[model samples]
Each structure stands twice: as structure tokens, then as C-alpha cells.
Target: MKNFLLLIVLSLYLHSSFAQNLLQPELEAFYNPALRPFYFGVASGDPQPHSVVIWTKIVPENLGLQQIHWEVATDTLLQNVVQSGTGEADSSSAFTLKLVVENLEAGTHYFYRFQHEGRYSPIGRTKTAPEGEVPLLRFAVVSCANFPSGYFNAFGDLARRNDIDAVLHLGDYIYEYGSGGPRKKKKNFSRPHIPNHEILTLQDYRTRYGQYRLDPQLMEAHRLLPFIVIWDDHELANNSNVSGAQNHDPNSEGSWEQRKAIARQVYFEWLPVHDNPQRSIIRSFRYGGLAELWMLDGRLEGRSPQAKGTGDPALPSASRHMLGEKQTEWLLDGMKNSTARWKIMGNQVIFSPLNDSKVFSRDPSIRMDRWDGYPAERSEIFDFFYKNNLRNIIVVTGDVHTSWAFELTGDPLNPSKYNRKTGMGVTGAEFVTPSVSSFNFDEVVPKFVTWEAKRRFCKKKNNPHLRFLDLNHHGYMTLTLTPERAQADWFFVKTLYEVDYRFKQKGGRYIEYDGNQVKKNKKR
Candidate 1:
């Protein structure tokens, strides 16, 4: 440990990790180390296939200012030329250079590489979204990755898949808390974080992002494809809403606005995202005419204080809003107005009915903090889809740290007969992707959890409109969207504690309940 500290300090002394000099050899450690090592790492995000963002950072001996060259190839052999470019990184943005390459065949796999200080980064590969209404848009959905809970074996497998198009991370990208239980810091960081604990400042958030970005599997996944990202509570504080957070007490932690601003600053600085003035991440992206992805900012514009959410578990109110007025309106307007054949909402929370046990006599306010918490808001959204006949609508989500695929039901006027075989509201379909590696019910509520997956599955098949639900396992789900169908492949990882990150694959079905009225993944 002392040797590691010595190395870090020496690296800092020779070349600043936060490079103060602007004209020196750019890819320096102090400016955010993108230095090469025995281990090869490369990354690309914010992808449009032909034009993608490639980034790399290194720690150098002198850490002088340097210019790096980037090349994008038509073939892995690099013999066939398509597009190539050059970019220089200095202390300004922390030694990371994002090269935007252009003009390639639609829906193609292009190899990219970076050249700096005579060292080459690992060959990074990225793909473009299919142009026309092709058969699939297979990619993973994940969130809330706490490094100590486990490894990102799931990310490793997803990165190896040459078939996937992208990754949709529905927030909790990295937790804002200190090491808990098994998840420990790789080393004692130089500067102590805010509150001597939780992240409440720019430096805190930046440190967390840096640690997460250092994960080889995570970086590999990002290098291989475009990532559609959104943040949930933990990015700032657990169970946070517009007003405050579950992890913060204004009396103890300072003003909520100040903490929020710091969180947002680090997130925007690290991630490639557009600023939403509405204070929500309710934005839309398209894949020609096949499908349109509407990512939500469920945390920022939501109603309710931080503690009253899942942490409170009993405050289900018709008036407790999640997507606040404006953002909810934005989501509705987008859903109602989109031209794509399939409408996929990247919701951070589960959007379907989630009940505990088989008890049908319990009150509706049983499950709080999720869509179950905001009954009225969920109703309005459900009614929009049902009334307008929004076909092939699927909500992909994360944050529960457990996997669930549900046949979305409708408003049960009295909230009774919810678990009954009949007399229930069933609207669309929602798939909840588990966390990359957060503790599930098995670990926390072990005795109560079961392996049958029946009662849970009943939540899907019982209500005429509900479809599927898997409450265990931590992995990502891939969706293949077509004009006539949209299929989801729920891939699982074998283990998260192991260091090598070996993963196993699980088979998941795709739904085609629109034109053909089938509910299976008929593979290409």
C-alpha cells in the first residue's frame, strides 16, 4: 500500500495528474491519466456509428503536452480506409481526447485506435445504429454499479458480443457513498471526500467517476458501443428527489441545491449528455423509423422528499408524483407524438404493479417509492397509451437491483382485485433490468426470497395484460426492435466477486404482440 502511494506521489511530482500546464505533452496523469500500461484499455461513447466519441487518458513520466492521433477503419485490417482524425488533449479537459470520426456504411462495426507518445491504445470497436427498419437493436440495460458488491463480469460479456448495438444505463452509474461492507476502495485516495464520507461536491463526484471509469470491463463496454446513460438517486444521494435526498439532511448536509449542482457538474463533465432545461433527462432518440428511445430523468423532476420513497415503503399517494408535471407532460407528449414503430422508455424505476406475496387483500399503498407510489401519474400515462392505442410500447428500467419483466396493467379504481386473475388494469409491457452488482432481495431479505419465481411470474401471467418478471440475478437486457416486433434478451452474469470477470449467457425471449400477435423471440 505504501509503495502504491509512493508511485502515485512520484507520478504526480514528475507529471501532474491534474496537469496545470496547457502546452506540455497533453496526455499527462495530473490532467486525468490516459497512460498506457501492461493492461490495454480503450473507450468510445456518444456513438452515431460513423461519428463516435473516442477517449483515452494516460499518466506519463514527464507528462508533457502531447497530441494524439485517432483512426477509424472500414475493416479491422485497417487496409480499407474510411475516416481518420487527430485530436490533442492537455490539462484543460484532463488529458482525455474525444475524436469524432465521420462517414461510414450504415449499421457497421468500425475499428478505432489512438496514437500518443508512440504508444497505441487497445483496438477499440464501435457500431452504428441500424439505418432502416432492420430486425434488431440488441443492447444491455444496467445501473447502480457499486464496485465492492462485485465485479462487472456482466459488462465483460456484453462487451464481447459483436451483435449488440448499444448500452442503456438507466442511472446509478456509480454510487456516491463511501466503501461499505465488502466493497472497499482500491487504495486510500489522497484527498478525503466531502462529509468525510458521502459525495456532496464536484471533487467527490469526479473521484467516483474516475474510479468507475478505470474498470476495464466497463471501459471495454463503453469502447465497444454507444451508451445511453441516465442517473438515479445514488448518483447524488440515495432515494433523492427534486427537493432533497435520502442520504442528505439539509440540516446536517448543507443546502440541497448546492449538492445537486455539484453532482450535475461532475456527471455532465464526465458523461456525454445534453443539458435539459426542464431539470429532467426526458429526451428522445431514434433509429430511423423502427424505434425511438425516450430516456427519463425520473430522479431530478420527481416529487416527494428523499426518505419517503422505497425507504419509507408506505406512502403511496395518488398525489405523490414521480415525473413532476412538466417532465411527465414531456414524456406523454413524446409518446403521443413519436413517429417510430416502437416506443421504448428507459425508466429508472419499475413501471408495473409490484406486490409482496400473494395477498390480494392488502391496501394499494403497500409499495412506495416506485410507480406504485404515484398511482395517479401512472394512471395518466397508462391511459394515454391505452386510449391512443400506443402499440409496441416497452419500458426498460433499472435501480431495483433485480430483474423484472411485466405486462403493464391499468388503474384498478379501488386498488382492489389487483392480484386477481380478472378485474385488473393491464396496459403495456415493462422490463426491469437488475443492477450491475447491487445486493438483491436474496442477500438482504434472504429468508423471505424464493427461487421458484412463480408468484413473481404470476404478476406477469395473472393479469391478462402482464407478461414476465425475474427478481434475482444482476445483469443487463438486450432489446431488438423491428417495425413489427421488439424483443428483449435478458443476459445474466455468473458471478461478480471474481476478478477475471467470466460471464455466462441466459436465453430470453422477444415479444411480437403487435401485428403478428406473438410473444417470443424469433431469432434472425
Candidate 2:
């Protein structure tokens, strides 16, 4: 009996050692064999006043159906369990579990966890949206975290903070690139894509996502805060549209339809978002009477193929759309009817016009992929705002990998329509958050060139309504909204080369309630 017990102990030790060795060298520190089958950790998202979605993944050693148990409680120890249930995972969903815990209290915090056999996954904390007279709300706005480009220091910094209620991820969560690409190095660290190839199939996308979730910072952030996420072009392919992506090759790789479908399937399976019946990602969250957030789907919905140049004949077509007709109507109508004091549009690209002639030599149509590409539709949205006399509208955008604050107006150049200095006639305000770790102007261009570009872009004579621009930085923004004003504070991480999490407040901008123009925040 003594010999048998010793042998059992030795076998268990070897099993743990082999499992640890299976992880990538860079991600080894984050991998915990004790969590076992539940390696991806836990995440919660799409929080409602009365419900929230909790997610997890189980990679069983054997290829078979796995019984997973989940629990939600009011205490971290999970002794005061509020909701409990069981779920089955198999190859069908890649063993990912996204379970909605319903009948939760409004404005309340909850602790949740998932279990397989006897092992328990990480405990995640999430909160439900507040209802009825919310005095304040804060969100960390972030985007563009390319895995191969750098480390997720920004996310690490965010995870250390406790002030933020939730994280608003405005897409480009992961890049579909190979290992040896141009953006494969960051300082001394060699961040490589897992598959070491351009991901194009179902398994490829899944593998990439698995690699990203293994990051300690991202996993910790998700474990602490609920995330409201939306995808941009990079999630599927570079500059993807309804039909095809610029990076996709139908002849060589596969059909665009098949690739897109697979990407969507994997996205829903992995993330904690609620998969509606129609699979339409356009959804709204009501924060009591204070604010209402509308997360838009700009990439896969109804966008026209990007124009080749300003001379492209399609640029002038009134039919060309960015948000498409149905989504436009839904958004405009929702804004018109919303009773919330603040209407926040969670956008994936720059909405205001940006004249890039002064900064770059690219054609005017080079920015056609953004709202500038679909001018007619953008104008229509502006027209609706003016016609309805909409007030307190805020557009939070990502994807540019830079920070910019714009005073939304009929036209920034037309003095008669918009007074840049006095800020007489403005439709709304837009705050563009910097990328989390993607390449900024400084990375792609020489330091001196980027300095010159920044100087030209921020010149008062050009783009007068442009209040602020930061062409060089890798960080996130904190958007704090109250009954009287909304403010965005930019925070920059010290470095992405290694595991440093120190950050500093770069700058900030704010707009008072009913004040359409953005103003520089008073220095602290």
C-alpha cells in the first residue's frame, strides 16, 4: 500500500510538469496547470441591469463531452451562492462556455466561477448596469491590441485599477498576421503569432484567440471587469467589408463567405457577448437616465468596398454606405427616441472629416475606409442631429491608433457653419482613444517625421475644430460621465517592451452637458 501511494504521487507530479511544458515559452508564466482543463480563465460581458453573461473554456485531455458547473454569488468565497447551473461542452463549441446568469440585481457586483470535475477556474467579478438616476459612470475605452506588435501593458495597467466600472473595447482585439511580419518585434521582446501564419480558417482563428487569452494582463482584466466589446476590420481581416476583405484571397485561401462565417462563429464562441437570434451585434445598453450606449457594427454590416483614390467614381455615389441603411435608421431612430441624458455612440472609426493632405502625401481617398469614405451617409446622420436638435451626443471611436478630439459640426472648414474659436454651432463631440499596443506614427515613421506631422495636423489654421491630436502613444482612455459633463483622460503606459505597468496621464478633454464643443481639461 505504501509503494502504491508513492507511485501515485510521482505520477501526478510528472503530469503537472508535462502540462506546464506544453505552453509557449513567453506565456509559460501565465499558464497554471492547477486550473487544468479551464486554462483560458474566466470572463464576463454584455451586462444588463438584471442579467450578465459569464464565459469560460475547457480543453479536456480526452476528446469527449465535458460536464461544467458554474456558480454566481454575492461573496468572493462563493459561500453565498445566488445562481448555480451546469453546462455541457464538446467539440461543437470548441469547449467554450458562455452562460447568461439571469435575475441578478441592478447596480450590484457579483462573483462567478466555473468548475470541471474538481478543479475550479478563476473567479471573475462583474456588475450589472445601473437603473434610475445614476450619479456617475466610468469606462476604460481601449482598442487595437496587435499581439505581435507589443505586450499588453495597457491592459495590465487597467487591471490594477479599481475605479473603472467596465471596459469598452472598440475592436481590433487581435491581428491576423504571421510571426515574421513587420510588426513582430517590440523592443527586446520577440512577440510572435502562435500559428506563425496568416489565420484564414476556423481552427486558425481559434488558436489565435486562445493565445491572446493566455496573456496574464488580458485575463486578469476580464476576470475583474465586465467588457463591452465590438469587432473592427482586423478581427476578421484587414479592412473587411460585407463581401470581401483586402487581406482575403478567395482563389488561394477559400471563399470569403466561408471565411467570414467561420470567423463570426469563433468570435461568438470565445467571447462573452450575447448571441442574439439574428447574430446582429448592434446593441444598446441603458445606464439609467444618465447615458445610453449604442455599439455599432461598421465592418461586416453594410460597408462598401473602400475607394481606390479620391478620383474613384464610387466616392460620389449617394448609395455608398458605412453603417448601411438599416443600421443607420436603427441608430438615428434610437438616438431620437432615447430618453437618456447622454447618447454615446461606441464607434469603430473616426466619424469627423480628417484632411490628411497636410500630414501625409496619401490621396484624399486614402482615408475613404473611415466615415470620410461614406460622406453622403455621414452627412445624413449630421442632418438628423441638426433637424432633431439633438444635444449631449458623444461619439467614442477607435481604430486610428492615435488620439484626437474633434468638435462635430456641419463642416469644420466652413466658418459660417462652425466658429472654431467661439464654438458657436456644433452638432456633438468626438473623442478618439489611442490604440492599446498597435503601431503608432512614431513606430512606422522616423521620430522627426512624426513630430513634423503632429505639428502640421494640430496647426490652428488647418482643421480648426480639431481640438487635440496625439500621434505618438500606446495606451487607453478613461471616459467619465456625470449628470453635468463628460470627460476623457488619456493614460500612457511607460513601456510595452516588457512587463512594466507604470502609466501617466498624458492629457484630457471634456464637454459640459448640452455643450457641443470640446474643451481642454484644466491642468491638475
Candidate 3:
């Protein structure tokens, strides 16, 4: 009987050993001398008044567990350490580790790094949002970073700047399309996506993210500053909504729900974002009394089908919702209760209506993918602000691939009805940043100059509220907020094709809410 018990125990021990081996397979086969275990580098996000999330991924040479030690210090030399801890890196989460270092003082700059097996990662810098009162706040805004099209010079430029508090990545952090698309034919891509195919599965998404993070420019941007990000269409699929996407084919891509789940899982795992029970990405961040940034999600959670064409009469239906009921309520309540001097909406798409009558017809032709498609919902939001007496609202947007500064007037079609002198019918002001690297109208058109001239003329003639427009440029915007006024300085890179590109100050504009006024500022 004793011998039989010993045999059973031995069998159990062997099974346990096999399970561990299965979870962590040999990594030597995939090892590269140049790629360290911390190849993806370090990143931090979701900053609060007292805490922030620090993230790192361990690429082990073997499948065994790795113990990662992290430290947060007031100085860059690690001499003045504030918080330190250790965590395990295992295969359960692609060997990724995220630690929420809490109980730190607010409005403070902190340096962080991770060490594994005696090898230390590059140090990262992060800062927590201010708590009570802040005299000033600054943020660098960017979006739509397509790796294959060009280099991330804009990100590198932003990384070089030391004035911004945090980086706001509106969306399209990574494009899922593989090579051989229309873009590839137009211009030779500097690099091709891994797998060389459209990503559809969790592993595929994770691999794509790994490839993007490998980019030195992008990696440096993450290493230098904390990023507050939201996923746009290309992160999952092109023109993606809640139920379906224009790029996703159900029969070929398998289940849409399953694909979305996989994409969301990978996004949450790879990014240093904090997830809630409802799996919603809509959240708010306050910078003391200076400003409150409401980062919104317009693609996934509760969006309806995009209008197909220019004259989709049903597009005006109230049932065609954008933020849905719950999120809309949350936004309205948040704005109503917010006491910050400036309420900045970190939105993915253009909030103000963009009308192009000459291009389409005498009637205003709107892009269905933006807020214009859901006319009733857009009107409801504007009405809420008007009725509630909300002021000092600044909408910072991306996704249009062009730079524009406009006043969100009540009647976008007929700007004359709204008094531009007093900004009487204007609810807010919008500053739309150009694409980081994605192709714009000029790049896509055969006759770039003619197309640009026509576009600018038509846009300006129809949309009088549009104070400025730069249809072709690749760069970002830096927004600075004070107690009195908020300013947005637009900067454009010399070129996206070159790795080492210089950014030039394009222009800038600011809004004063004391008397409801918008003005263009030449200062950068």
C-alpha cells in the first residue's frame, strides 16, 4: 500500500512539472541578440491625482518565470526612491507586468524603471495630475500613427519637448492593415507589418502591437512621457462601430463579436490603461482647477451604422446615436458638475459639422462617419451646453487627417446666422490636429496642388466658422491652458518620409470665455 501511494505522488509531481513547461516553452528558438527581454520598452498611463500605472513586458529567453523589480523615484538617478516593488512575469499575460504605484504626492514628476535578471530597462518619466489648484497645464495631442506609411517623426518631436504634462493619443495608435493596400502602391512603405496580413486574432493583434512598440521613435515617445490613449477604427477594424465595421467581413473574419473581444483583450493587455467592469474606454481626467479632459470613445461602445452616402435621409433620425444614452448622460453630468476653468474634450472625431457644398451639391454634404451623421444626437449635445450655460469648452479632435480650427456654432450650414462678432451662437471651439503619418487629401490625389486649392476654397467658402485649414501636413498640436484662456499651437513636421525631421510652428489660436470670444493668435 505504501508503494502504491508513492507511485501516485510521483505521477502527480510529473504532471505539475509538465504543466509549468507547457505554460512557459523554450524561448531560445525566437531569441535575437538585438532584442532584449525589455524590447518593447516601458510605458505609463491613466494618471490620477496620487497614482499612475507603470507597464513593462518581459521577453524571456526561456519560458521560466521572471521577477521584475520596479522603482519610482523623485530623481532620475534613482537616488531619491519613493515607491518600490517586485512583480512576477509569466505567460498568462504575454509576460507583461503593470504596477499601480499609489500614495504619491500630486502634481509631482517621478522617474521609473524595471529590472529583470540583472538587466535594467530604460528609465521612463511620468507625472501625476495636480490635485487642488494648478496655475497652468499643457498637453501634446496626436493620433493616427500608421507604421508602414512613414516614420513617427511627430512622436519623436513631441518626445524632445519638455513642456507638456502628458501625451493624448486620440486613436489609431496602430493600423491593422497589412501591406499591398492602396497606400503601399502609392508610396513604398519603410517597413511591412509582421504576419504581412490583416490582423484578426488576439495573437495577431499582440504581434502587431509588439512590432509598433519596437519602433525607436515610438518607443522613445512612450519612454519619455505618459500617454492617455483611446482606440479608433484601425485598432480593431476600419470604420468600426459597435456591432459591425466596414472593413470586417463576418463570413471571412469569423464572428464579429469574437474578433472584437480578441482585439479589446490584446489592447487592454498591451496598453497601460485601467479597465472598468463595463469594458468602457470613456473616462475623465482633471488637471487641478486649470482644466478637465474628457477622453471619449466614438468607435466601439455604442455607435450605430455609419451613413452610406451623402444623401442618407435617415441619417437625421434621433435613433441613430453616437454616444448612446448612458455615455451621453455621463458626459452631460460630468460637464455640468465640472468646475475647472477649461473643459477639454479629447475626442476621436471632429465634433463640429463640416459642410462641403461645392464638392457634393448645393446642399451641405457631411461625412457620415463623424458627428454630422448623427444630427439629432449632435444637436442634443449642443442644446445641453446652451441650456446648462456651459462655457469655456474646448474640443480637441483628430481622425480627419487635416488641421482645422473652427467655432462650433449652432448653425454650421449658415454661419452668418451666428454672430461671429460676439460668438453668440457658438457653444465651443475646436482644434483639429493633422495626421501623424496617414495620407491626407493631397497625398491621395493625383494633382495635389489643384485638389488642395479647390478643397480649401470650398471649405472656407461654405464653413465661415473655419478660421484656419491646412489640408496637407503631418504633425501635432500642443495645447496650453491657464486660468484665463486656452491656447493651441499647431506644429507641422518637415516631412514624414525622413527619420530625422524638424517641426515648424504652423500657427496657433486661443479662446477667451469671459465674453464668449474666439481669436487667432500668432504666438507659438
Best by TM-score: 2
* lDDT for each residue of candidate 1 in 1-524, tens digit (9 for 90 to 100): 99999998888775543433322221223232344631225666555534555566543445556677778887777777677777766544445565556576667788878777687777777776656666656767788787667777778878777777778889988887775422233353232222235666655666666666767788778777677788888888887888876688899889999999878766765664543444345666777677778888878866665223343553445566888887788888888898877788988887875654353224333356577777677878877877787767788888877766665556432355343344244444677777787776565544344454446545443333344555567777777766655666677777666744455444355556463222445456
Provide the overall lDDT of each model, using Cα atoms, as 2-decimal numbers.
Answer: 0.65, 0.86, 0.80
| TM-score winner between candidates 2 and 3 | 2
My TM-score estimates for the predictions, one after another, are 0.79, 0.93, 0.90
* Stretches of candidate 1 exceeding 4 Å from the true structure: 1-40, 58-66, 77-81, 88-92, 99-104, 181-196, 272-281, 302-320, 357-366, 412-427, 451-466, 500-509, 515-524
Per-candidate Cα RMSD to the true structure, in Å, reads 6.6, 4.3, 4.9
How many residue pairs clash in each candidate at the backbone level?
33, 0, 0
Shift of residue 375 alpha carbon in model 3, Å:
0.8
lDDT assessment of candidate 2: 0.86
RMSD of 1: 6.6
Among residues 3 or more apart in sequence or in different chains, the pairs in candidate 3 whose N, CA or C atoms overlap within 3 Å are none
Question: Residue by residue across 185-237, what tens digits does model 2's lDDT show?
Answer: 45467877877889887767887888899888898999999999999988899
Cα shift from native, residue 144, model 1 (Å)? 2.4
Displacement of the residue 31 alpha carbon in candidate 3, Å: 8.6
- Model 2, residue 58: what's the lDDT? 81
Span of ten consecutive residues with least summed lDDT in model 1: 22-31
